[model samples]
Target: MRRVLAGLVAGALLALAGCTAESPKTDDGAAAPTGPPCLPAASAAASPGPAPSSAGKPLPAMAVRCFDGGRYVDVAQLGNAPTILNLWRSNCEPCRTELPAFQRFVTSAGSKVRVVGVIVMDSRPAAQSVIDDKQLTFPMLEDRDQQFSIALSQVVGRSVASALPATLFIAPGGRIVYTYQGIALDDEKIRALTAAHLGIEVAA
Candidate 1:
C-alpha cells in the first residue's frame, strides 16, 4: 500500500514537471506570458481601409494612346469631352457579350460623351476582325503593352492581374464619374447612370 502511494506521488510530481516544462520561455529563460504578439503603432495605423473611388477626384495627367479611324492618336489632343473608355480583348467571352450592349449605349450617348474602346491582350488582326465582324463604329485604341489597362487599374484601386471587360466613365473635367469592373454592362444601367450624371437622355 505504501509503495502504491509513493508511485502515485512520484507520478503526480512528474506530470506537474512536464506541464511546467511545456510553458513558453522568455529570452532570459523566464516563463513568458501567452497572448497575441504586440503590433507597432504604425502597423495598426497602416491597416487597409475601403478602396477609393475613381469618381472621387479629377484624373491625374495621363498619356492615353488610341486608334482613331484608321490611325493611332493621343488622348492629349482629343480635347475636353466626357469620355467612356472601355477595356476589352477579342478572346474574352464577357467582352464579346458586352460589345453589342456597349455599341448600343455609345450610339444613344450621342455627342454628349465619347466612348473609346481599348483593345488589350489580342493580336491586331484578331482585334480588327472582331471590330469588323461586329461593325463597330467607334474609335478603338490598341493597348498591346496593356499600359492603358494598368493605368486604369491604378485609378480604380484594382489589381492589374484582373481580367478585362472593364469600363470607366470620365466626366468632362476628366474626373472618373463611374467605374464598372467585371460582369457585362447592361444598357439600362449605363443609360440611367449617364443621364443622371451627364444630364443627357440616352435613347433606348
Candidate 2:
C-alpha cells in the first residue's frame, strides 16, 4: 500500500513538473529495452467517413515520435478521422485505470474513430510496461520535452493544467473539438464525448 501511494505521488509530481525518470543504460552505453513497439497511427489516406464539422482550433504544428523509438508522427495530421488523444504516465494511478478502458473502447470502436495515447513526462520503459501489461493496442506517441503540452496551451489560448490523463477530442481536419483535462475517463464517458464532439457514436 505504501509503495502504491508512493508511485501515485511520484506520478503526480512528474505530471506537474514534466520530468522523466532516468533510463538505464547498457554495458556498451546503449539503451536496452523491452516490450512491444508502440504502433503507428492508422492510415491517413483511408477516409474513415465524411468529415465532421471542422470548426475548432487545429492541433499545434508539432511532431512526436512513437514510444518504441519508432518513426515520428505529425500531430496535425491525426484527424484523418475523429480522434481521442489521451496523455498519460505509467506511475499515475488514474492513467493506469483509464488506459484499459481506452483499449476496450478502441477494440469496440472499429473504423469509426481512432484512439491515440501520448506518454507525457515519463520514461519509455516505464510507459511500455504499462502498455504491455494492459495489452493496449492503440498508437502511442512520446512527449519527452513537453512540447505537446506547450502546443496544447497555445490552442487553448492559456496555460493548460500540467496534469495526467488529459484528453483531446479532434475532428477530421485535425481541429480540436474538445479538451478534457485532469480527469480519468471511462469507456462510457469516452463514447459520449466521441458522439458529442466528433459526431462518432461508439456503443457503451
Candidate 3:
C-alpha cells in the first residue's frame, strides 16, 4: 500500500518535471525478449461498442528498437491484441513509481493485452537502472528521436504538453481508444481503465 502511494507521487512528479532518455544500445543483435509476462485472467466478452464503423484509425507504422533484446520491430506488429503503449523516461519520478504497477497489471493481464514501454529522451543507463530496481519484465522499446510522442499527439488529438508518462490504450485491430497523460498508480483504476477502454477486465 505504501509502495503504491510512493509510486503515485513519483509518477506525478515525473509528469511535471520529466527527463529524457538516450537511445538504447541495440548494436549487439540480441534476440528480442520472448514475450511479456503473463497477464491476469480478467476476461469478459466485450459488450461491443456502438455501430462498428470503418473508421478505426491505425497506429503509426514506425520501427522501434527493442530495448532489452536489441532488435528492431515494427510498431504495427504490437497492436494485435488489446495494447497499452506507455511512454516513460528513466529520469521521471512518476515513471519510476508507476512502472511496478504497470508490471503487475501486465502480469495480471496474461494474454489479454500487450503493454509496451517506450523510453525516450532519457539515457539507457538510467532507464535500465530503474527497470532493474523495479524488476520490470515488460517489453520495452526506445525512442531517441522523440518523434513518437508527437505522432501520438496527432493521432489521439491530444496536446501532449508533457509527453512523458503518457499511456495510449489501443484496442484490438490497432485503433487507439484513449490516451491518458498522467499518473495512474491505483490498481483498481488501472484495471477499470483496461476493462473500459480495451474491453479486458483485470482483476482488482
Regions of candidate 3 where Cα sits further than 4 Å from its true position: 1-25, 28-56, 159-161
lDDT per residue for candidate 3 within 57-175, as digits (tens), equals 67887777666655567676655567788888877787777888898897887777777888887776777788778888877777767777667677777755374688878876667
The candidate maximizing TM-score is 2
Lowest summed lDDT across 10 adjacent residues in model 2 is found at: 24-33
Better of 1 and 3 by TM-score: 3
Give the distance in Å from residue 151's predicted Cα in candidate 1 to where it truly belongs: 1.8
Candidate 1 stretches greater than 4 Å from native: 1-55, 68-72, 76-79
RMSD of each: 22.8, 14.2, 16.5
Error of 1 at 141 (Å): 0.9
- Model 3 scores a TM of 0.72
lDDT-better candidate, 1 vs 3: 3
Better of 2 and 3 by lDDT: 2
